[model samples]
Target: MSARPRPLMAALALAAVTSLALGAAPAVAKAPAGDEFAHPDLKKTYEATKKYESEQAAIDDGYVRTDDCVEDPELGGMGYHYVNPDHIGSTDPTKPAAVLYAPDHKTGKRELVALEWVVPNTGQPRPRLFDHDFDGPFDFEPVGPHYSLHAWIFKKNPKGVFTPYNPRVHCTPCTEDHAKPDEPKPAHPKS
Candidate 1:
């Protein structure tokens, strides 16, 4: 094979530069085997969410509610979504009502994608895995006074549990259900 053409190389270089300039590249997720549960400080909180790792177990325990799916792009894409349950256990650190799920290609079931930790609002800035560098939305921040952390235990999040988006997660079009008139949505407001 002959060497690549100069024009083709130039086009490829230009495309790479353009994508980086536009911040079009997807974020890398974190490793799935996070031992936050082993942290002495967060032990209880981690234990609290263990059951939620199983979507059905969480639903039966009132940790989730049926028909709570909604359009969310943070996890993967259009088919990805967040589900808020009727109850969240543990007051010590507080657990997230929003459980992220993705449609399973082979099983045709909503498989658990991630679990979030929703801490109470204490009038301070939200939390993050890092200190003060988390500039994303409060609901996804893993640290801070009133913040949240999305733990991608079920799914691999190359960007880590604290990161905002997970490229591995996604949802199917028209898979979401309308929220009840009186029910409030999980506070995943856009920034």
Candidate 2:
């Protein structure tokens, strides 16, 4: 014959099973929409670069601004690119080659929107991270052929996290010329 279970133990077991069956599991914290860090690499990258949220801080760390704000008629705007020449070609996810920012329509202040990883094309298979492949072997001029990937960590990109452009990012101060992507891609402005 089986031994009888203790009353307290039986009660606890029943409650636990009931909770599980009724879907009353504990709640977990959720990262908001596109801001969610899907991988540890992304989280690490965000933590490492979050200080750049302040445009001044990014400038102090050697990120030089590009003259023209970037936009794609089809995909949408990518905002202003502030590139760190030192970070180019580095595979470390935390060290993005560029940071993207957009000027607020009213305030005209640049707000950090995204992070970009750029590696010069050296006949390599292609650089990839965060489960996404980099875009383009396009002529990056001066930098020449390169593959780039954008992480829309700071902004909600309806297209995707790794997409090169974001519909939500706008160039409030950008002129019409800079908004068109087809016109021979502009050269990175000399600092």
Highest lDDT scorer: 2
Worst 10 residues of 1 by lDDT: 1-10
Residues 23-130, model 2: lDDT tens digits: 122222234455657566888787788777676667667676654566654556777777777887877888887788776666656667888877888999988888
Please, what's the RMSD in Å of model 1? Answer: 19.0
State each model's CA lDDT, in order.
Answer: 0.40, 0.64
> With candidate 2 superimposed using the best TM-score fit, by how many Å does residue 56's alpha carbon deviate from the native?
1.2
Candidate 2: how many backbone clashes? 0
What is the alpha-carbon lDDT for the whole of candidate 1?
A: 0.40
Worst 10 contiguous positions by lDDT, candidate 2: 1-10
Clash total of candidate 1: 20
For model 2 the local lDDT of residue 168 reads: 70
Candidate 2: regions farther than 4 A off: 1-35, 173-191
lDDT tens digits by residue: candidate 1, 44-114: 44455555545555544443233323334434331222333232222234355455556665556655566
